[model samples]
Target: MKASRDDDPRVGLDGRLSWRPAGAADLDAWAALIARTAAVERPVWFERREDLAQILESRKNPTAGNSVLGFDVQGVARAYGRITKNPDGEKALGFGCVDPAWQGTGVGSGLLGWTEARTRQRFAADAATRAAARLRLFTEQQHTHHSALFEGRGYRIVRYYSEMHRPLDGTLPEPILDDGFELVPFGPELYEAVRQAHNDAFRDHWGSEPRDQEAWAFVVNDPLARPDLSAVVVERAGGKVAGYQLASHDAQSAESRGFTEGYTELLGVRPEFRGRGIARALLANAMRRFAAAGMDKAALDVDSENPTGALALYLKMGYVAVNSSMAWDREF
Candidate 1:
């Protein structure tokens, strides 16, 4: 049923649907739509209402363009899309999802079209600062329909990522550290150093972005973050952080799947310190901590083509790819 003209958000030009800008109060509606979509088995990160709220908060930074357009039918919010302008060399846009109830209603097309237009407008505003801008978005590989949708609009699959999981039986390979290195738990004070080390560790990585304090706090300080479960390895020789693993929880998702899981949100070992067993030590310590905390499993996602053999290492450590997602891209 269509809503009264005055009560509806801006109507679809054809009078088939309606939409309006969203705010924090729309969290539950967004979460409801997301829950409907996540019911499908796929390699995708789960998002709770709090997660969506935090992401919206992250958009407060000037560089990350944030827009949430709630799509509705008869005054009820049933679908929505959020596009965030990310670190610019690639000119990335955040993920978008629609309600299954509106699949054939042109909602998806309208949303993607808006994302591209919004991205272009944002990059144009800072044109003098941008160089070689390319637009990109990520979607689940199993969603062949979505893959077809992007490809139909000139996007190409640029990368493949795997959602990997490991049972937390407290049997992760023991972290083996060299004589001059030691594992240290991260404290709030090391926020800056950790951010710096993240950039250094991922400088050679594909799609890596530099993070400022705002970005760091937005992700690392999320509600599920357990600073105690995270581990940092420092070279005792000069007290420099060689590697680190930041852990978080997806309690809702885990419980939904019948086990509690801890996430290795970010894990990296600086290039100069790669072969010293720093990464292994960090992983082992984090995994042990999660298991000790009574988590039934541990998880992380990896780029399938990672040059560092991260996927192979995770497999070696008994983690298995539970799902795969593809990165799609097109030049702006």
Candidate 2:
């Protein structure tokens, strides 16, 4: 399919819908549309309005120009698409969804076309900076329709990720810090330090780019962030972060799903600190904190092929795989 022109606001939905770049004013409608799509496509989790707002407001994301929303004749949002480039500019990630009622109606295909064209424009604008680039889209394993759509467009599965959960009601492991290291409560003072440590830790991980201050702050300061449940491992002598685990609780999800869950949003251990049990210790510490906070379960997602053997560690830590997703990429 040919991508729509960058300057075009119409997505060729057979004139069934009007299209425009999504803005702050569309947060409520956009979130409602996402919730509806999630109920059918990925029922396990959904982003809240606040979460959507952050993405739209992030300084690193050109949301105004890169995100589009399609509305029906009644002015109800029916489809959405967004493209965001990584800090390194080597890859652009695509996110979008169509109302379940609108599936198979060509709305999704048109959204993808717009995002593809926008991604190409972005890369072309920065051709001097990057010699090669790619566009990636993610879909759950159960969403065969989405996979078919991507495959039909020449995208190929490049990686898989597992979403794991462990009941906090069971016996929890005790975190044992390695010699010369200690676990401390996460605080605003350690934000920069943890950011640096995280970037260093995931440097070799697939598709990971260093998080700039704006992006790092967005995660650490998210409304749902639970600093009380997060921990930072530091060297006793120098107090430099060696490993870290950040967590969040979605009250809205708990209310809807009938169970409280503490999500491990980010976890990492610097390569120099690997094999010293820091990663395991951080996870165990967070699990205990979640249980102490009256959470019913601890949840996290991990790259299936993590070089650090993180998936094995989580499995051993009693985290059972609940669902999985695949990443598909079209390289340019």
Considering every candidate listed, which one attains the maximal lDDT?
A: 2
The local lDDT score (0 to 100) that residue 93 gets in candidate 2 is: 91
Residues 184-234, candidate 1: write the lDDT tens digits: 889887788889999899988888877777888886768788888898988
Give candidate 1's total backbone clashes.
Answer: 0
Worst 10 residues of 2 by lDDT: 5-14
- Could you tell me which residue pairs clash in candidate 1? none
Stretches > 4 Å off in candidate 2: 1-14
Which number leads on TM-score? 2
Q: lDDT values of the candidates?
A: 0.74, 0.87
- For candidate 2, lDDT tens digit of each residue in 1-332? 77545446344443687888889899999999998988777556666688888887777676788888889989999999888885456788999889999999888888888878777767777745464668999988998999999999999999999989999987899999868999999999999999999899999999888899988988887989999999999999989899999999988787667889999999999999899999899999998999999999999999999999999899899999989999999976
Judge candidate 2 against the unseen true structure and give its global Cα lDDT, from 0 to 1: 0.87
